[model samples]
Target chain A: MEQWKKQWTPLLPERVAEILERLPDDAPLLEIRLRCDRPLELVFDGSDRIVYGNNKAPIVEENELKALLRRLTGYSAFAWENERKSGFITVGGCRVGLSGRMIRTEDGVLGFSTVSGVCIRIVREVKDCAKPLLPYLLCGGRFRSVLLVSPPGCGKTTLLRDMIRIASDGLYGAVPCRVGVADERFELSGDANGAIAFDLGTRTDVISGISKSDAAVRIVSTLSPGILAMDELNDANDAKAVSEARGKGVAVFATAHGADGKDLRLRPAIGALLDAHVFERIALLEGVGRLTSVTDGDGLRVDAVSQ
Target chain B: MKTIGIALLFALCCLAGVRLGAKKAAPLKMIRAMRAGLQSFSDRTASGATLADAAEPADDAFRERLSVYLESLSQGSAQADAAGRASAAFGASDAVRSGAELFFCGLSDAPRAELQRRIEAFGAVLARAEVDAENESKQARVLRSAGFLVGTGLAVLLL
Candidate 1:
């Protein structure tokens, strides 16, 4: 087996861990999405490929999910209160999304009352996945603000990550720009314990475990990055923050979840950002090897970056 | 020689009675300390302290048990495993032992209020432990004093 595949070892319960290890070597294990009481299925080889780990496929219990979270957060329930409330946390570069009943008070959401499910999205950095799309994202010899669009699980994160690395380390005919990553979920940067587990490249700054909206504005003022990269802009506050940063002339490389270019224009938040000209280029991410539809700031489908 | 021997036995009897009394009383002190530790834990948890950093500096024995529990957790041990290990290391009765486990086990994906509540409930466990320890200690105290007196009376009668 390749050494790179070993890095995807999720901190699963012992029973599931043993089952994962027994998977056939030829199995193209892309992601392992687990939910409480749901049968464990492996995503690989296709858009929705499923591989059975066990004939009985042990049901994931609430206790098991709690155990997993305890292990992932190093048992720091207090420190992870916000993430727990938000229903998502990143551990070892994988985004662990959770589902639970929201516990709110007079002010706002306090935390979760009862945790129910967990989906561990394994982040695989597909190096050079941006090679074809890099041209559309660059104009002449400098970076342009590009927003990656895709429905959830369509490889937007994987592509956006590679693009950031390329822009930070320098790509073909383009100089290495000072890149700042606002990694709210720790998915893009893969940084933990003051040590970067993933090689983003030389001269890349990442701020994790903060709201992307805050990080977007702060990274510009503090890091003064030539290009600001982030993932999943959702809501008016995030759009407002990114627009203000782009107004400062710092090119923003970010992503959003949507079906297509039409969906981008339909979404109220993206429409607001587009009207302000925050994004110069928008690329729609599809399955692996599929072309990414590149559109101009006006949401017009201009060209397709071939895979 | 006989007079000296009687005096020595009497002194030994008195010392044994005192030791028994101290044994009976020591658990109450430990129980109070545990209660204090629970309050600190509640305060710390309410302040959003991380499990690794939430150390309530109580008595030496309590702190030692907490360190073992948190260290095991920090080292990536499962909740039950870490809690069980800490409980096993505790030199106390079932109530205190299970209380230690409950303390660590409650550090799940729970909110500050829930965790604080868990610590609040720990007081009952400490109270129960104190009662059990006190009962054993009281039995020992009675046995020591009464047995010494009975032996001494029998000795005098035999002489």
Candidate 2:
């Protein structure tokens, strides 16, 4: 079993862990969600199952859920205040989503007064997954500024991560470059037990725990990276940062939450990027790790084979 | 031989008094260590260390209890329940037990500023208790000297 998968077992209640451990090592588990007094949900690659105890679905007690949160935060909630406010905490490269009674004040969201639900999303490195898309993403033997468009949970981040690794490592006839990753959520370059969770290639420099714009500007000024990789360009600041970096002669590999070019243009920030033709290639993803098609910045179809 | 036995008895009484005095003074020392420990813990937590990592610099007794609490947390026990169990280690003092329980409550989820504020508030409580402990320690010293004088008087009367 992958170490990341094993990390979840210890955080779960004993009975749930026992039930989960019964699955095969390669069970393709995608998520483990726990709700207070509700049945445990296990999401696999293509299916979801509810685990039962005795005759009915095992219930997650309130205390058990809180304890799980404590363990996830390493029993130091003060340290993860920002992440808690963001409604998620990353542990061992797995993004644990939290939901509960949010305490709000005049300033904004204070934090969770009581966490009632937790969703642990399992993430694994799909090595060389970007190999086939490399040809289309490259132009004239040089990497193009590409934007990966996908719906939620459609593996846009995973593909973008693999693409960054491939470009940084210069593997399989790809151009090598110093890649600066603006990991706003720490999801791109997660840490597990004080160690880097994923192999992002030797040339990748990651800046996390800051906004994408600040990290991008800092990376460009300090590291002078040839390529900048960031996940989820959602706001104007992100789009402007990517545009500014591109203008400065740095190629960008970014992912956006959208299904196609139409979806991309529907959002104000993404539409501006599309209008400016910042990205030379726009790759659309359907299903997990499957590229459906590729289009140019002008919305013209780029004939390419899906990997 | 009888005189020597009387001297031995008087010496034993003085020794008992010294031991009792030391016991009375122990709380003051313990509280001082706890204050220092909490400062260190705050520093470590500010630097993004887990409670287990920060617990090493705590007072010996509190560290052991905190270890148990952390172990209970790892075993999936609720924060309140774990703190309840850990606070039982301060069996001799209800004030200390309650203070410890409050210290452990919701600490895992407290923000950095809130944590610092809590520590300062707890430090105030500890400061007051420290004053009380210091007074008790002084009283204990007086009690010990009185016991020694009483022992001497009894021995002289016997002579």
True contacts kept of each: 0.58, 0.89
Q: In candidate 1, what are the lDDT values of residues B1-159, reduced to their tens digit?
A: 877777677667667776767776677777777667667766665665555445655556666777787788657677689789877876566767877778667565555666766676667787788788778777777867775786587458646
Per-candidate TM equals 0.71, 0.84
Instruction: Give the clash count for each candidate.
Output: 0, 1
Q: Specify the CAPRI tier of model 1.
A: acceptable
Candidate 2 has an lDDT of 0.83
Please provide, for model 2 over B1-159, each residue's C-alpha lDDT reduced to its tens digit, 9 standing for 90 to 100.
Answer: 989988997898788788889889988887887778778877877877778877787678657877878888677677799889887776536787787788777777777887888778777777878898999899889879977987898899888
Candidate 2's docking class is medium
Q: How well is candidate 1 docked (DockQ)?
A: 0.34
Superposed model 2: Cα runs more than 4 Å off = A50-61, A139-142, A193-195, A303-307, B1-25, B56-62, B76-80, B90-93, B109-114, B135-159
Query: Mind sharing the TM-score for model 1?
Result: 0.71
Clashing pairs in 2: A77-B108
Best-matching candidate per TM-score: 2
| Local error of candidate 1 at residue B27 (angstroms) | 14
Error of 2 at A196 (Å): 2.4
Quick one: best DockQ, which candidate? 2
